[model samples]
Target: MSIQLGSNQEPPKQERSAETRRQLLDAAADELLDGGFARFTTHGVARRAGISRGAQQHHFPHKHRLVTAAVHHLAERSLQQLEGITSDGSLNSTRRVLDALFEQYAGPLFAAMLDLSLAARADEQLRDAVQREEHTVNRMIDEWAHRRLTGCDDAPADFDELFAMAISTVRGVAVLRLLGHSQESVQRQWKYTRDQLLRLLVENRS
Candidate 1:
């Protein structure tokens, strides 16, 4: 006989599975941030997640898969946050867009991405995974920028190139933060870069 569910009953199996995966990915991201890829391990992630090793292994069979999945998970979350920020009607200015993008790159997500990227350089398998995810995320950002910045189906022919440069510049500024540059110095440099990018965007659209 099937048991009747009560208020204290556990969640359904599918939901529990999804929650476990989320926990593992969150733990994996923290592990990467706390200890770069060189020291990242599924065991450590499982420990951080407060789950058994078997459980994490059941979800992510290998270290590379776990790490890459963690990066993808974090990237998706960051992109969602960006979408939310850009959706606000009051923030419909080029400078605001740049600010949102800069804030995105300056967060822990980018720090985790940097860790994966550095480690990927020496690991062929991980490199492929990281590059694939990077390409996917970049494409998503390109589409997002086109839609948000232009608000039209037809963007300028050079729009993508110009946005790519802007993103690269912002990412460079983010690296400065990771490199231990003072907050004041980073802000000074970003202000200069932001103004230059704003000018470029205006010229490109004009």
Candidate 2:
């Protein structure tokens, strides 16, 4: 099964196949957002997408595939959002991107991901996918940190550890925010925490 998003300027008529795929994905995301991952079943995705169960199965054979695809879709959207941050060609770009990401996802997205991780304990495939996404996000964060470190050409040997620490710090804020902390308070504390983390990274740079 293939997924496509047809261009609006193509013609007067919308493509049915493309529209169906979009609906499926969009609806799945909405379901995940509305309820936790446990609440997101294949039937629920189909109902939300307004597509037949057979069609959903054609695209995604199982619930795990649908969930993994949704994770990838969200990751791609995030990368797109960071495109500008990457292109800034300044060390601050790294920090800014991290800040923006935490700000954007500290609420619902982070909460949903946490829910998914807890759900993964009983599902091996889901556990693997969640781990994969964690590693991918960590790699991105590590690369950004390396770029921003004082010596970009020769980062510290423990760069990964340091990067993981910073990621944890941000994720802690996300959890707190998701649990009803005020946005103003989260942002205030987050900025201070980020600055301190960056300073430490800079100091540790080889």
Candidate 3:
């Protein structure tokens, strides 16, 4: 759920700074989504953000900083949506949240993250940043599952591994779908994976 802070008043200077940062990150996300891994530049982002290059550098002195911030920014948004999805002890709630998670992985969020992931495989500096961000994201999801999904907190040690595997399988399926896999094949595999996870979730709660 969203929590609004402060009075319902006009924009303060600090709020304006926050808004500028948000706009820059959002523009970076759009650029990354459209341009893929190689097309992100501070100048391009500045142009897209309708701000000066000096302003961009003020917020992000380096390209890596910009990209890293953008990734974290987008991730927070995705996680917020994930956090908002309601779940109780029920199997149906588990299934719905799982489906929501799948959608989170299938969209531009996934696309942007995949770009960094691929780059990280070869670039050590980028790899370090990516890993750090990934750890944060994973930890957030793990906590979210344990807290929001009733049976998860009481699950065994293997629950982490099982849940992680479910996520990896979804990523694999997403890649295959991108490579022109049949829709029927994609749906079949998705069902099998999702159902397996859901079953495990329910069984563990029993």
TM-score of each: 0.83, 0.70, 0.81
| Candidate 1 off by > 4 Å | 1-3, 87-92, 152-157, 203-206
How well is each residue in 1-206 modelled by candidate 2, as lDDT tens digits? 99686674454334766677778887786788788786789899998787999989988888887876676566555555655554232347546756765764574555667788888999888899987875675466446534444335545568668767776777787677888888789878888887887665554452
Ranking by TM-score: 1, 3, 2
lDDT of each: 0.79, 0.70, 0.77
CA lDDT of 49 in candidate 3?
A: 95
Who wins the TM-score comparison?
1
lDDT of 3 by residue, 1-206 (tens): 99777687679889888999999999987888889769888899999999999888998998887888787788788888887777765778878777776676666776777778888798888888888887777676656765666554566557667767766776677666655678789778888888888877666667
Tens-digit lDDT string for candidate 1 (1-206): 99898899989999999999999999998898788888898999999999999999899998888988888787777778777645322224767778877776777777777777887898899899988887776677656765667654445678778877888898889789877789999999999998888777764454
- How many clashes in each candidate? 0, 0, 0
Worst 10 residues of 2 by lDDT: 82-91
Query: Which ranking of candidates, highest lDDT first?
Result: 1, 3, 2
Query: Who wins the lDDT comparison?
Result: 1
